[model samples]
Target: MSTALPQSTGVIAEYRARLAAGSIVFDSAQASAAERLQALWAKLRGYDPHPKAPPNGWVGRLLRRKQVDDVSDHPNGLYLVGDVGRGKSMLMDLFFEAADVPRKKRIHFHEFMQDAHRRFHAIKRDNPGINDPIPALADLIAEDAALLCFDEFQVHDIVDAMILGRLFEALFARLVVVVATSNTLPDDLYKGKPGRDAFLPFIGFLKQNLDVLVLDAARDYRRERLHGLNAWYVPADTRADAAMDHVFTTLAAGAPAQPGSLMVSGRKLAVPLSVPGAARFDFAALCGTALGPGDYLALATHYQTLLIDGIPRLSPDNFDEARRFVTLIDALYEHRVKLYASAAALPDDLYKSGEGAAIFERTASRLEEMQSDAYLQLPHLT
Candidate 1:
C-alpha cells in the first residue's frame, strides 16, 4: 500500500516542524539519520509486492523479477545503535509511522523471539518429518511482513543465538527488510557468551546486510525533559502516590499500565505495573523477598525508569530488607536507570540504625546524586 507524500514535504521537514512547535528537542545527529531513513523509505516504495509463481515458465520469470526489484533497488536495512535515552527508539517510531507499507510490523525483540519459538513448535507438530524448519518459518514471516522493525535488539539465550543466523539468512534471501534499534553495536552483540565464537557468522551477516549508524548525541533527551523534576517523595501519602502515577503515564506516552514479568535465571520476576519503557513495583515485592544483584540487573537492563512504592524507614528490625534495598539501589545506580519512589523518610534518615548502617551512608549519598540533573543526564549502561 502506498501513501501519498504530504505534497512535497518529507520526514525531515515534519521533524523540524515538531522542533519549531516545541514538541521535540532538536538534535543534529538524529535529524541526519532521519533524512537517510526517509530516503530508504522512498526507495522501498518503488518495489511491488512479492509475486506468486509456479515452479517454472512465465510465472517463474515473474518471481525472479520480484527478487531483482527488491535486491537491486532497495538499500541495506538499518542497524541504529546509541546510548540509552538518546532518542533512537523515538526516531525509529517516527520512521515506522511515516512509512506507508501495508506489509510491515514493528515489535519489541523479546516478543518477536517468543513468537518465533511458538511458531517453531507449531511447525514441528504439524510437519513431523520436516528436515528444516527455519526456512519455512522465514517464509511465513516474510509472507506477513516485508518490513520488520525491532526495538531493543538483544541476545541472551543460547537457543536464540544458535537459530538467528539461519533464520535471518532465510528471511534476507526472500527479500525481507529488517530495521533494528539497540544499545549495543553489531560487533559487541552476545559478548562473552559461553560459546560466542559460534555466533560470529551471524555478526558478519548483520554487518553485511545492515548499515550500522551511531546516534551519539551528547545529551540524554529524556533526562533533559525530566530536569528539576522531583524523584523522591518522603512520608508516602496520597499526593505522592498520584504524582508517581502521573509520571508513569507521562513517560509511557499514555499506554495503559499492566502487569509485567521478567525472566531471569529461568524464574519470573513479577512487576505490578508496566508500560513500554517503565515499570512500577511495591517495596515488599522487590526487597522484601530474597532478590540479589542479578535480578536487579535484569530489571535495570529492561526498564529505563522504575518506580518503587511504600518504602518504610529502615531499622534493626528490618535489617535484611535494608541490605536488599542497598543492593537494588547499587544495581540501578550502576546502570543509570532512573528511580522514582515514595518512602517513609529521606534517604539519609531511612536507615538510622541497622547492621549495615555504615555502608548505607554511601547508598544514601548515591540516592541523593541520582536525583540531581547531572546524574540524571548520564547514559544508561547497555
Candidate 2:
C-alpha cells in the first residue's frame, strides 16, 4: 500500500490540509485509516452502482456480481473500532464528506435501524402476501446509496440484533459497501443479552465482510477538549448558554440539529436536539415537564452525553423542579452519562435551604464526582 496520496480529491489530502492549518493534530493511527479511506474513495470515483434490476429478482441474481465485469475490483469496506473519545466518528465523517461517490449516505446506527424497521413495515403493509421484506428494503437502500457510513454502531436491543445478520447479508449480496465506527468491537458486541447465541452470527458476519481498523490514538481529542473548555458553566447567562451550545456542537461532530421523540414504557419523551449518542436540551424540557424515573431511565439508556442549558437556581419555591432535576441527575449519574450544562450556580449552591435540601446534597455530590477525569473515562452503560 502506497503512503503517497493519489490526489486532492480524497480523504488523505483533506486530512493533510487540516493538519497543516492546525485544525487537527497529527496522529499516526488516524493517518493510516485516512489512507485506507482514500484508497476506497479513489476506487468509488465515478463507479457504477449498477442499479438495474435483473430479469429475475434479487434472490435469483444473488450469486452474480452487481457489475459483472467488475467482480474482482469492488472494494471491501472498513470498520473502525475504538473506545469513546477517540477520533473514529470524526475521521469517518471526514471520509464520508470527501468520498466522490454520487450515491452515498452517512447515518447513525440507531436511526438506520429505525428507518429499516419503518421500511420493512411499509413493505409488509403494501404487499400483504410478501414472504420477506428485508430484501426489498435492502434494494431500496442499495439503489440510493452505493457507500453507507454508520456512526456509533452498537447493538443493545434484541430486536435489532436478531435482524442485523439477515439484513446485512442481503445488503452485501447487492454489493452495497458499508463503513461503520463502533466503540464495541465485533467480538465484544451484544454480550450478556438473552439472545446472545442467536446474535453471534451477526458478529461473525461483520468480521468476515469488513476490514477492521483499531484506532488507539495516543490522545483522546474529545476528552482533552472537554477538559480545556470546562464543561460545567455557571451563572446560566447568555454567555453560558453560548458556551453550552459550543459544547454540543463539538460533541455532535457536525450532525445537524433536529428534534425527535423516543418511546419509553409506552409513552413519548420529546427531545429538543437529538444527535445519536449525544443530546442537547433546555432545562425546562426535562424538569419543567411531567417526566419521571422511567423517562429519565430511557434517556440514560439511549444517550451517552447530554448538553443542558438554562439551569436556574433552585429553592423551596421551585421544589417540584428541584426534585425533578435531582432525579434526572441521579439517572445520569447511575448510567455514567457525561453531562455538560449551564447552571445558575455550582452543584452545592443549587437547591440550597429547600425542604429536600439534604437529598439534593447527595445529587450535588454525585454531580461533582461526575466531573472527575476518572468518571469521564467511564463508558456510558445501557
Maximum-TM-score candidate: 2
| Residue pairs whose backbone atoms clash in candidate 1 | none
Per-residue CA lDDT of candidate 1, range 97-203, in tens?
Answer: 76657788898787688778889878988999988889678778888887899888988779899989988877776777888998889999999997789999999
What shift in Å separates residue 33 of candidate 2 from its native position after superposition?
Answer: 1.0
List the pairs of residues colliding in candidate 2.
none
lDDT assessment of candidate 1: 0.81
Residues 262-346, model 2: lDDT tens digits? 8764467889887757888889988988889888887886788998888888888888888899989999998789999889899
Reference-based TM-score, model 1: 0.73
Which stretch of 10 consecutive residues in model 1 shows the poorest summed lDDT? 46-55
After TM-score superposition, the amount by which residue 304's alpha carbon in candidate 1 deviates from its true location, in angstroms, is 2.4
TM-score of each: 0.73, 0.80
